[model samples]
Target: MDEEYDVIVLGTGLKECILSGLLSVDGLKVLHMDRNDYYGGESTSLSLVQLWKRFRSNDKPPELLGSSREYNVDMIPKFMMANGTLVRVLIRTGVTKYLNFKAVDGSFVYNNGKIYKVPATDVEALKSTLMGLFEKRRARKFFIYVQDYEDDDPKSHEGLDLNKVTTRDVISKYGLEDNTVDFIGHALALHRDDSYLDEPAIYTVKRMKLYAESLARFQGGSPYIYPLYGLGELPQGFARLSAVYGGTYMLNKPECKVEFDTDGKAYGVTSEGETAKCKKVVCDPSYLPDKVKKVGRVARAICIMSHPIPNTNDSHSVQIILPQKQLGRRSDMYVFCCSYAHNVAPKGKYIAFVSTEAETDHPETELKPGIDLLGPVDETFFDIYDRYEPANHDEHDNCFISTSYDPTTHFESTVQDVISMYKKITGKELDLSVDLSAASAAGEDA
Candidate 1:
């Protein structure tokens, strides 16, 4: 284990795995290690029995939930936007060949005590019940403006400059009401809060375009996609990519301590009394606790249900966003659901999660608004975990620690962090446009 490498990644989380694979593909020698035997550190998917063990004290799961092996419950639940950054990375690295994907069934937004489908196209905008007749016309025009606005085409600009204008200014031009603005900003744009309304309109506009484009990917009602089994397959897919590039992996390594040089820069990792040296180290927040600080907390409710969410058209999988304005909160709340159709649960059963930034001490109460939308949950588990970010990044210390996962049920931030960290570590931008066929050499799925 004394061998030296260019980079030694210390976690099997999706971000670390993607980086290791990208670096390996770039012809850098890499070594990946995880304290746990399985992939996905904080973002793992567990079986029904494992879920019982973690939250229910391992008192054998109820038989009514079906066999434990039939379930693949995600610890940190999120969906991949069909045309989003993660999908681009997956395709670029040829990780798609190792996995199959299914389009999500629906995407809804919580309004004034009701739920409404997010308008994806100009036609849907005009037909939406989310706005009044006059407001619908206004929204339809805005949708058209967004759909037609191209980055390189000046004619599409229509006398407006997204780079210099504010999103709030653009919405006001259309005479859009507060409710229309709510779904547009929080739902379609997928903003974490209303703060984006004050930022440059370009960011929000691009997000809206991405959402619309993703919705058009499968035309299956929503803009998101999930793997056939669950997100657990994602890390493994990237791990395979790394392996094909001659990267080595070690799992179930205990008390893997980062060894630093006399000058404070990380030099290697010591595990089981054997030290493997490396020029740089990348890891999740859990490894270097002192370098990260708690920023906030996430409260979530994991539920098992026999039926789809009440008002979602009986969709097998869906994402329902609760805007901060409608919910009177500082941040938008998210409700993510998937069923056996996605191979995440037993037949006829669904896994639904209601998650948001922790505003109160009680998770059961904090997530009540989103939980109420679920008709009757066969089983429910409430949990709250701290969110952290790097507090001390020693440029001299070659440790590139990742921030804790946020409460968002999307991969936008996750993929962005991976890309940014890749640049900082390798001093080169990760070219998502670069196609790598080397990773597709093994796809003999049974």
Candidate 2:
């Protein structure tokens, strides 16, 4: 462990592994270490036995759920937009070779106390049951405007500047109903809360365009995809990439603490009796807890079920969003479901998750609206984790700490955090111009 490098990365989570890999590819000597004897850290997939051990203190899983090893339930379950930034990162780093995925079967949104499939195109939007006959035409126009929008092409802007316009203002121009705006914002834009409405409209337009383009990629049932086993493959894939690029990795390294100099800048990390020197240190919040602060709490319910979520057209894998307005909550609630079809569960079993930015202390009660849609759960586990962001000055300490994962069931925000941290540490924007078509994820229709 006694060595010098350009960067010493702590935590094997996806964010840390990705930074290590990208930096190594950029010709930086990097050393990555983790305290846990695992690859995925907090984002790792857990087998039924492992899940039982963590949540139930060694209680054995029920025999009715099938072989315990058949399950690979993700601790932080989320999906990848087929054309989103995460997939771009995977392809750019050539990490797609180590993973396979399946297209999610459907994308649905909760509207007026019921679930409806999210229209992925203008044509579908016209036939949606959630909109009125007149409202459909208005929405169609809005979708078409988004589809035709080009930041450089003023002709496509319809004389409206989204950069200066608020999302609420942009939607109000079409006279959309409150329910229509809820789904469009929370489901299509994929915002965690209503806060985006007050921000610039350009961001919302781009998100909707990403959804449309991703859905068009395979013309599949939905725009999202999931790994064959679970998200555990993601961190492991990046780890392999880093190693191939000459990055070193150490696992089961106890007390992997960041060591800073008297000038308040990090210089190395200490573990066991050995220390590896570095000019910069990157780690998750857990590695440098004192440098991060809690911003919010995420409440999630992991469920084992015999069937799919109701009203999803019996999708084997699906992502459903319960927008904030629909439930009179301050934040949206997300439901993610996967089955043996994705190889994450037994042949007759399914794995589902209901998560939200927790607004209250009671997780079980806070997630009931989503859980009620899951039909029946053979087994369920409720968890709450605090979300955090860097509190210390990165420039002062040369220590880059990743923000805790948000409650969204997508990788867009997570990738954004990694890219932002990479820019701050390297003083260069991540280059993602690699051709996506050259990289393929072996997949089937979910």
Candidate 3:
């Protein structure tokens, strides 16, 4: 207990585990502790019984819903982009070897009271019903331009400077309709709202390119993938990586308190009347609430069903993005569904989630637009959780806290938060460059 470590990570959440792994891989001694006796903190996956216990209290689930052990429902559901930063991190850290991934079956967008697949290629764009005949031609041309665009290739710039223009400007140049712009910005680019339209076009261009590349990687219906068992495998895989590199882990520790120096710098963590010294501390916002501020709240509904989401090409797993404009809301709503094919549920069962940034106090009513899309749910659980971010700088107090998870059912923003915290803690940007092709192959083999 008297030994000092370079860092003490105070939660077993995905972000904390990944940071612990990265720091340990960098030859820093890390002491990872979680008050709960589990690898995942807020992001843990629960069995049917656990889910029932948390949401339904003493009531037991009906037998028609299937066996309790057969269900692995994620508390914070998200899918990985096939070629995104998180996948790169997994491959780079050799954590992919510990997990198996299956490509998601569909990626659809909601517009004009209907859902349609998001076209990732020029061929699909030409066939898409989301646009008119002339609009399809314009969109195809725009898709081709994006596909051929290279940051260093002046000829590929199409006489437009993405860095100097807004996404709205670029979309208008192609004469795309407002509906076309909605899907392009929110679905294909994975933006949560229309705010990105006013941002630099370069960012959206890169996102579109990434989406296209990811779709091309798997040649699947969607650009995302999920683990076979659920997202619960992620934190544990990273924890194993951290352990292999000499990081220590302590689960079920009670009252894991952050000890601070008189100058307000975090120096260690105390638990069970024992103090383990460390030069710095990293943790989720829950571990040190005073250092964080609530930014918003997320409303979510977890549903168990016997069939795939209606009108999603009968996909066993899918991600549907309902743009804010279509829903007449301030933020986008997401529908993520995974079935027995992904090993998250029983043979004939599917787990679907409807989530969004909370705009009203009634989560069930707020998520009605998304929930209504599901054909029929055997059971549903509604919840709302507050979102938070660190209010203090790590440079001042050596206490780096991760922000609460957002409602977006993708890893892009989550990984950005991890990378941001990694830079703050280590004073270096995380090198995420990896052979994505090779990693995709490995995932396929898995």
Candidate 4:
């Protein structure tokens, strides 16, 4: 390595990317790298920044821009797709838009397994998607104080309720069908990565309400914003910004070891056989010790891609599915069904995110640990279809499954943990032992 940086960011998570860019934008010589080939640690996308810029530049007059008058409705609409009963309600409430708020027609199959459309712009859909803590108590005082945000008004003091509500309480009080509860609970699990019963519903609601209020304020009407390309856009865009500030963005450069000079500071970062030198290091891939200790487990998701796209249209919709009969205190399974970010599949194909508990307790030394894959917390994945029907496609063959495990939860066993999740979800046999440990060994080569 020829250069020395004033600052070096340990992880390339979007947050770190933002910090790197901000520092670089402030005229600091920064070096940002990930321990993986991928740049975005948790947030990954192929073409996020470009798409976001285009979405932002769009000048089409928004039909409805929430309650705010000065915000741009164009980007907000893209968050919603165009389908679903819940989605329709959101549009009526001025919470959803067409472009920004797309819908995935098949979410929950209830009543007659009928197809249902989820509106992309629907505030309710996003609300249900995010605040799984609302225990059927509509119009609760759920507002948060964001230092002076308008929605922080005491009159809209709904967010304060999160301090008291548990996710379990919200699921029961809302009177949602078991399947719906499971689906929403599954989302909460994915976001928080633990038992829904463990998370405080009020806290979830408060966080959501805070974002929603921010959205309403920024976009004028709806408070939903998706990456122009996909969730991947945020990190990619920040990478671009990092480049402008003299930061180096290296894809596939997995960090093998941190060689500290005689001084305790990290003087060199080894990737494969190469190394880079820097002074200050900001470790941000996984949360630092202080952050992860509070949240003990990791969350894992299996992204399923099937050939022959389904009828759903919305981009930012989520379906929660739980078992009809309670499995212990929670449902049997929790599935978040949605179309992959626009254009993710080759067309005629669809993607859904299946959430389940990670092998958080498993030891890394075990070659292959077994995991019990639970179905959509409800009856079947297609169960939600009874309520809302979706577009048709070919058979359920030609599916690709991808899984992600939070490293903080399964620090030493991150890769193995992900592999175990995949096997449980897809029922396919895998030998990730080579891939897992080899990755660590290969990091030395990086």
Alpha-carbon TM-score of each model against the true structure: 0.97, 0.98, 0.99, 0.46
> Per the 3 Å backbone cut-off, how many clashing residue pairs does candidate 3 have?
0
In model 4, which runs have C-alpha deviations exceeding 4 angstroms?
10-16, 34-38, 41-205, 211-225, 251-256, 270-275, 283-317, 321-334, 338-341, 359-446
Ranking by TM-score: 3, 2, 1, 4
- lDDT: which candidate is best? 3
- TM-score top scorer: 3
Q: Return the lDDT, model 2, position 290.
A: 91
User: Model 2: which ten-residue window has the lowest total lDDT?
Assistant: 437-446
Q: List clashing residue pairs in candidate 3.
A: none
Model 2: number of backbone collisions: 0
What's the distance in Å from true for residue 103, model 3? 0.5
Model 2, range 188-306, lDDT digits (tens) per residue? 98998889999999999999999998898767788998989999999999999999999998999999978888898999999998889999999999988899999999999999999
For model 4, where is the 10-residue window of minimal lDDT?
379-388
Better of 2 and 4 by lDDT: 2
Clashes of 1: 0
**Model 4 Cα RMSD, 1 decimal:** 18.3
Question: Model 2 segments beyond 4 Å from truth?
Answer: 439-446
Better of 1 and 4 by TM-score: 1
Reference-based TM-score, model 4: 0.46
Q: Candidate 4 lDDT, tens digit per residue, 48-139?
A: 22222433354432222111121111110113211111222222222222123222223331112322332112334546432345532321
